[model samples]
Target: MAPRTYGGLAFIAEVYLGSPSIRQYLHVDTGSNLTWTQCFPSSHSFVDHIYPKYSPEDSNTYFDAECETTAKNSTPKFTYYASTGVCSYELTYGDGNLIRGRLAEEMITLQTRNGEFKVVYDVYFGCNDQAVGNQYIGTGILGLGTGKFSIVEKLGSKFSICFGLIMESKPTHNLILGDGANIQGHPTVINTTQGNYMIMLEFILVGAELKALDDPVQVHLDTGTTICHLSGFLFNFIV
Candidate 1:
């Protein structure tokens, strides 16, 4: 499905969660690994005007890790709140944005080419009650990363995104999850030891000048990072 854009910086998608479902617009962040949304009874959060807060108590399938139990002999595998016995998480962005809350599980609703459907996966998502930073254009982030707790890994480890160019008029981009991604391209494969998507850069060509690098540099393909960063030597040579 195509995601809505704001100021050509943030991409937003309409996502539904829980039983009975609460629809929310969230930022589509390929650089992140955890999906989270502001929940009701928010105490330290910046109010989001576009979508309503999610209340886990309203859903029958919602299970707070701190207050519930999993199968016998099986401990909750993800991070949790030691004080409350609930799974909890705290995210601190480079820009000083922070979100802290409990980790929970619930059914996620999606609309695919086959039509709308609901998948009851044991998703590890944050239910944030405290969020602080710049005013977010969307309610949450839809993390598309390689981490074990990421939505991609939880949903079987395959997804695709086709970014459309931004224009004067509002434009949208494609985000496909699961088996129907249908990515068409000549793939350049690289192996990595990190959780985030990383690729090796051999060299860079500017105009007609081929600037070769002394050594290959590993760069991260991050959707959440707005600006491209290069080493001092590369940046100086390029400019």
Candidate 2:
């Protein structure tokens, strides 16, 4: 993973998938739960084919995740395939962008910058074949949200992600999973809002001046989301 692209703060990770392990660059998103990547020969797509797509047929470790439930009830964010027994999903972002894919399980390999290896087997993820927005910088997204199918849950109960200076000569990484992560700092509870990470904002201070925000606002911490959004009243009050 590295720095954000252009005006956005996007850090992509080097993740290997399947038996032989095909390399893929995935943008890290703490706001999402499902780790998804673009797949080859897409039946439908609007974004230009800029990056190479992942072929599931090539991966011997890939397996389709069947729908456990009997009924196929289509929702605004998810869909089920009863005929194929495949669990498919559709996610609508804040910007109204949709990412549609099929759920599957595959072996994953995480290689650190220091040549370290951490392999996790049977990790659930989405094989995206269709999209509606610009794919941006990576082949797909690496969801790090605190969800059932997230990388954080796959690792351990507690984890810490460190973002150091973006100097290539001085590469630094201290990603700790489990009890090894130091929990000494003044910690605040993180709430899950709309399947994403959220926190209550009390007030805004600019150069020691406290800004007025009548009520506490729910602020989402999304690494994948590049833009900052503020309510009209909050925006005017702050300025």
Candidate 3:
């Protein structure tokens, strides 16, 4: 759909955690969970995988979680956008890579319905590439969106997480977490169905111009989806 509005909730540039002594960067994604990272492997760690060591000395926010082995395997069980959810989480992003590790009890900063607070939980923090520099968003993801395991889903009440996207030439756009506060006044077109967690949407294009259809089409608005897509037939006509 042709998005309107330039500002709502801004993408979090930085997030803090742990005592004043230790903290780290993390990427907030609404997609998947099973938070993991690379840590010092004991005799149990596989020798085949390339594990980037996490050292407390180098990072100001590094702290010991006293983690124990939950499970281990050659490949991850979870899958998001082609990456497996092996015990050792191996993820290849566009420019950086991540290696999965175990979760430990440590403090993490997250925003809730009440406000922002630090909560101690196990996090995956091991697969950082040294060449990628400080690409970490803040220790791990702040999974929000409508996904099953999102941080927001785990919350007891209704709350929201905002995601912002930058347009090529036009102004930026903000995707709301709850009812979409930015588009509050605008005419919000939504499609709902049974047994589905998401609302479907269809952008109406008439002639050579893009516009909302008199009757919006069916679509799934999934925060977990990496990109917005249209069917081949519809796409060709729209373009």
Candidate 4:
């Protein structure tokens, strides 16, 4: 078997839905699962170009949330907008990107040690003119991490999560999960102030040196954020 590459994340794949198509990328997120993308009706949102737009008429997997028949084995809801009206299955990201759609089935491609694999899943995706311009950093988000409503809950199973960050200055950095790998050993077991949540980070290391912070920094496993963020103070100090 190929060496299992470890990344620090809750979900594994970078998957998203598009107009009449499905796109996949290496995604990083925390607590969300309404997979969608930017499309047809352009607007000033995140990077309103990477997301996909699905056409129900042409796509066999697409369905409308209003149709009662679409509710069979799926949840149908409407997304309300002050500017737009009620949208089916409205979705919002921590980064402020909003999507609207209903539950529909689609085939997804995933990478395995062997090769690419496929699975058909019922998902809520975005459609309409406003989402047309959502193309951004990653193709879309794979929402199967530890959360109240993660894809794993729907899938009803335990899954792995990992991510590799681009350490611009540092020559090496590693992200570990469950049982950590020893490449970045002696990781400080940082305490999370949050009572009980999967987002509590165990450590913040600087090339094997765990930097101690005065306050127990709140670190959450956010799936929606495309890149890791640090406050201005932390960023300056880290660099």
Candidate 5:
């Protein structure tokens, strides 16, 4: 995990997509599913591309994700229309930016720790053409969220993230996926609610005192977001 903050976002990893493999830098986000990259011939209102756009015509690995009988389970992050018979998607970000595109599968290449590249085929992603936002400087998002098409879910592997000391000038953080993931300490059951990683946070420890909350709060764990949101009632009670 090469975690450097830019545009108030943390962690951008170098990734390659397609058959021949075009290089791209993706923002590592766990808060949302539906991995997407900007494509060429976008709408006029689409976000300006600082990096080159992803062209499906250039990749032999590209395959369109077809229709499901029902629009409901078609895709967790996509909006389905029977007339098209193709998986099209629309995603909204926290900052009110919405992106629209078609869903497709392609080969993805990742750099290993030894600096060797590993190619994983048939990875689902959105080849987005329209978006509304200032557009953070990057290719797109590498979603680690719990949704069906997310990189983690598609790989069907357990992943782990290790954080370094806060005061360290150059923190040595690590993100391990599949067999290399190490999560052997204490274990807590994780529950998924609408692609959110939910865990019951029953108590809070301040100094030597352990204080129990009146009501157990369900916390969502997300590496994508840097801030936490609480209900007004919960905020007042905690304060």
Candidate 6:
């Protein structure tokens, strides 16, 4: 995996999708819940034309939830476009970027240590027809959050990622999923509430001074964000 620079921020991973298998460099966003890409009929959007657009018609394993009755009868539920009556999605990012498209399921290929493997899963991804803003520099985003539509949640309940320092010349990183994510670490048990991984931060230590927080602060661990965000009071205290 290589680091892709976007508006001064860097992201990792280049995922291969569909039967023909188009490679797309995407943001490995742990804070997001859905994985999507620019698809056919998205000429209006300012997408990278260098990469080929994904065509549902090209992949035999591709299934559209709206058009196919069998797909609609499947276990997973899908949202529909009000006017078109097609299964669709509309997403608005934190940076004010927006995307509108239909939902689809297709085969995904992954490169593993053993070898390359293919998995046919019900991938709930948007086939973007419209996109706004320059926040997205790559083909799409790889959602690693805890939502049902997230890749981690859909495949399994396990995933691990190691971030590299920006100053490193050739930074090394790892993105392990499923059984491969069985590596050990300094473990801390946390609760999952409101579709987020939350931890209680009791206090902080600066130099030799120990600062105890009045109340335990709830912090969300997000890989999508580049920097840590602190409350005004916490910032002042830390400063």
TM per model?
A: 0.84, 0.81, 0.46, 0.51, 0.81, 0.82
lDDT of each: 0.72, 0.72, 0.38, 0.43, 0.72, 0.70
- Taking the tens digit of each residue's C-alpha lDDT, what string does model 4 give over 147-238? 32344544443444333453223212222222222333443443323211234443578897887666556665555454687778677666
For model 3, residues 75-135, the per-residue Cα lDDT tens digits are 2233233243232334444335444443333344543345555453433333322213234
Pairs in steric clash, model 6: none
lDDT for residue 48 in candidate 5, whole number 0-100: 41
**TM-score, structure 1 vs. true:** 0.84
Q: Between candidates 1 and 4, which one is better according to TM-score?
A: 1
lDDT at 57 for candidate 2?
A: 91
Ranking 2 against 6 by TM-score, winner = 6
lDDT of 2 by residue, 1-239 (tens): 54334223466676888878878777777877778888776876543444445789988889987656312432224556788777888888777677888888899997644679878888878888888866445778788887667767777756666766645534454555555666656787788865668888888998899876678888888878767888897788777
Model 5 residue 164 distance off true place after TM-score fit, in angstroms: 2.7
> In model 3, which range of ten residues has the least summed lDDT?
1-10
Tens-digit per-residue lDDT, 1-239, candidate 1: 32344557666677788887888777877777778888887787675454566788888788875434332222113464567677656678767887888778777887775666756566777788888888566778888876755788776688877777744355657778877776678775645445667888887999999988788888878877667888797798789
Q: Which ranges of candidate 3 are over 4 A from the true structure?
A: 1-10, 20-23, 35-99, 111-140, 145-149, 162-197, 205-227
How good is model 2 by TM-score? 0.81
- Name the better of 4 and 5 by TM-score: 5
lDDT of 6: 0.70
Per-residue error (Å), model 4, residue 121: 3.6
Q: In model 5, how large is the Cα lDDT of residue 202?
A: 88
lDDT of 5 by residue, 39-99 (tens): 6667733434445456888888998886452246533446567887677787777767778
